[model samples]
Target: MLRTAARRMQVRGYADAPKGDEMALTFAAGNKVFYDKKVVKQIDVPSFSGSFGILPKHVPTLAVLRPGVVTVVENDGKQTKIFVSSGTITVNDDSSVQVLAEEAHPLESLDRSAAQEALSKAQSELNSAANEKAKAEALIAVEVAEEVVKAATA
Candidate 1:
């Protein structure tokens, strides 16, 4: 959580933020996404499909997320990135985006080689997996690990 929170933090659009309490974002890695004073639209890409966005008066919704870089284009045309593991998000059309993830980190803050190694390790496990359950779990690990690598390398 942040101590001195800004009025807004935008990615692809304006970020309608909470008042006062500085949001403390965390993940298995680090926090890189930012909320500036002016932002409007935001897209959170889950693992399965891709990128999804939210705007003012969009609607109330819950979405499952996948591993990918959450691309945020600020109002000034500056794009930002955040790496998310398997997670879920709750959004209200009123301009509130609540992201709850099993893992959330800033790609910019991660160690590139470490993440790459994690991806490699997960891939090895995935390749060696036998049976449905093991394969499924390994697949998830591999996916998250790959996402971490993407975030770190981005």
Candidate 2:
């Protein structure tokens, strides 16, 4: 796959990017790395601050990501979108972007109807919570479900 991407980059005149001109991206759920260190030209993450795009050599920083879609644009211009259920995003000095998500799945794998149903259930639970703690948890669940539905439809 790397060879294929390199060939496409060469054909597009993008093969001249310097060593540090590309970012290696990793998406992990728990201790499992779903996508490991794939070379990408760009990545967009949904953060608590706001959604933002990262390019190679971006200033090193850490962000708390919200439940939303994470988009990766590869060297060959192929874009992959995943729905992330909250996480932390870290940009390393070596032009590496790592996302540690509580849960994540490719957009194509998402079931919009299921997500909508979950959203409805969670909302109902939130409205009928017996205590503050339960209410908060239900609220978070509803938010996550809503984000999943949005990502699936997007």
Candidate number achieving the greatest TM-score relative to the actual structure: 2
Q: Per-residue lDDT tens digits of candidate 1, residues 50-115? A: 567754445566777787776655545566676767677666544455665665666677788998
Error of 1 at 50 (Å): 3.3
What is the C-alpha local distance difference test score of each model? 0.61, 0.88
Please name the candidate that would achieve the greatest lDDT relative to the true structure: 2
Give the TM-scores of the predictions, in the order they appear: 0.64, 0.84
How far out, in Å, is residue 42 in model 2? 0.5
